[model samples]
Target: MDILQYEFIRNALIAAILVSVTCGIIGTYVVIKRIVFIGGGISHAAFGGIGLGYLLGINPIIATIPFSILAALGIGTIGKKSEFGEDTAIGIVWAVGMALGVIFIALSPGYAPDLFSYLFGSILAVTSFDLIIMLILNVIIILTVILFHKEFLAISFDEEFSEVVGVPTKTMYLLLLCLVALSVVVLIRAVGVILVIALLTIPAAISRRFTHNIKNLMLLSIFIAIVLTITGLYLSYIFDLPSGATIVLILGIGFLLSSLFEYSIST
Candidate 1:
């Protein structure tokens, strides 16, 4: 309780909730559409934006937004239009993004003191500005989901049928990936680039066991994410462990328990 008195702790809690909501919403779509690989690609590619931010002396999170969106668009376009396989596109984008980050960091002329935080996450380091960014992105994500719920649902379940029925499946898919990009940027502040995909997928995966309805899934996922993240935050505070990794571990444990429960029910 006393730990809540610290501004960073308070900010971390807020960031956790915001991140949970964003990831829960977008992650549901990612899982349903089977685009986890593309999400991973966008997240790793965002590293280039982080490096560029360091080189330019700006906010890395902000830089990651456009950079991640481009990666998302590129992956979506190349996978659909080019003869290359989707896996190939993801691999190329992933490697190029990581390579660019290394190059940018090397050219920045100063040792990156906080690079590890961006790589693995440091929830305690979240600032007021980061909270605001998370809040705004949350608002955008929620609104987008609300506005296009039916279209997104249609495309996620059946792109060919959706298109035959006159839904703009391609546009909606690209937009979905872009939303995924934004979610990656928002999550980067809490879980970093490397572990971002796990955080994005795990809660939603757990929630799927309880509900097939999209709205309920998102709500349950958000609730589950909030619980796991805050629990992880408390444990980290008590033990002085890394918050991001701790949260991910907690989520992994939650998944294990859920799987066991599912198996028991099946048997």
Candidate 2:
């Protein structure tokens, strides 16, 4: 109760809700499409944007947006058109992004005081500006999903069938990856680049155990993510743990518990 009085805690709570919405909606597609690896790759690739921001003296988060989108498009195109496997493409981009970030940061004139925050996340440090950015991104994600729900669903379930039906499978795939990029940006503040995929995938993965319906899966995932995020925030507050890592840990535990529960029912 007393914690609510603190501005930082309130901000963290708001950010958590926004993050949960983005993750729940976009994550369903990622899981059903089995593009979790692409999500991870995009998240890491955003690091290059972060480094570019430092080098150019701009907002790292802003920089991450464009950089991640380009990376997502590149990975999608290369994986689809090239001889290299998808995993191989992801690996190349992932390493290159991290290396670029490291080099850019090193070249920057001064030590990056907030570098750790971006890597590990500092939800407790979220300000009003950050909250506003997150809110806008969440709204955009929701509306986009609502507008293209059918196309996304068709493409996710069966790309070949979707193409047969004139669904523009390739375009939809790129659009879905773009959404993943947006979700990654939204999550960067809450869980950082390194752990964003866990938050993105865990909730959807856990929810899938209970429901095969996409709408239900998303709703359940939103509920689970909100619960775990708030619980993790509170736990981090009480124990002085890293907020992002704590949230991921709580989510991991939820995944294990959900898996066990499903197994028990099956047996």
Candidate 3:
């Protein structure tokens, strides 16, 4: 295999780095609280955003902002106000969002090729414009997470007590949903909406088997994601494999291996 010095390989690596920041930063809470389904729902909801943008002939990522927020809000509201675990609420939101996206696509005038790209991801085509949006969103997400670190920590570890201590647990949760929305948008292009959730969850899940501190886990998740992403990109270049799938598969394998290693240690 030629040493991966190519321009496309460089672009894929850069894009994956951007993805690590967004997904790894926010995914900590999702994995801790076991809200993995929310990741899937919000990503799928992004498709509805894409369809809406297609019908309006606007930038899909820009159009996706509001829809993604609404989807997040919907997930939180349904999970909280209604009688259901987050998983069921997320499932409902997932189905509803995809339903709307398909309807909007049917209503659209012509074929917009970007939809499939959003669905399955195309790392080779991540643009400079996408990078700027990614950086801006990265700033917003990281700052918010850091500023509210204590409060989020309290909520993530113990919601009942945080509410008792007046942490406004519900509000914190809503904000978390919003953060997931932003992260999903940032990641969709690199890993695609379908596989983005796996990338978000698998690293942290694997990392947690070895660490408990949320801060350490977040750092470890970022490290694991970057490694898998770089490896996947290199493999894609050498073997001409699909980038997103390869990356996600590496993440899954990492999780399995980590779990086994931890189990062996315990035994």
The per-prediction CA RMSD against the true structure, in angstroms, equals 0.9, 1.0, 1.8
Estimated TM-score per prediction?
Answer: 0.98, 0.98, 0.93
**Per-residue lDDT of candidate 2, residues 1-267 (tens digit):** 998999999999999999999999999999999999999999999999999999999989889989899889988988886689789889988889889999999999898999998998889999898888889888888998998999999998888999998998899889999999999999999999999999889999999988989999999999999999999999999999999999999999999999899889999
**Which ten-residue region of model 2 has the weakest summed lDDT?**
80-89
Worst 10 residues of 1 by lDDT: 77-86
Q: Model 3: which residue pairs collide? A: none
**What lDDT tens digits, residue by residue, belong to model 3 across residues 221-266?**
8888888887876776568877777778777887888888988999
Q: Candidate 3: where is the Cα deviation over 4 Å?
A: 1-6, 82-85
Rank by TM-score, highest first. Answer: 1, 2, 3
lDDT of 1 by residue, 109-160 (tens): 7889999999999989999999999899889999999999999999988889
Global lDDT of each candidate:
0.92, 0.92, 0.83
Assess the local accuracy of residue 199 in candidate 1 as a C-alpha lDDT between 0 and 100.
Answer: 78
- Model 2 lDDT, full chain set: 0.92
Candidate 2 — number of clashing residue pairs?
Answer: 0
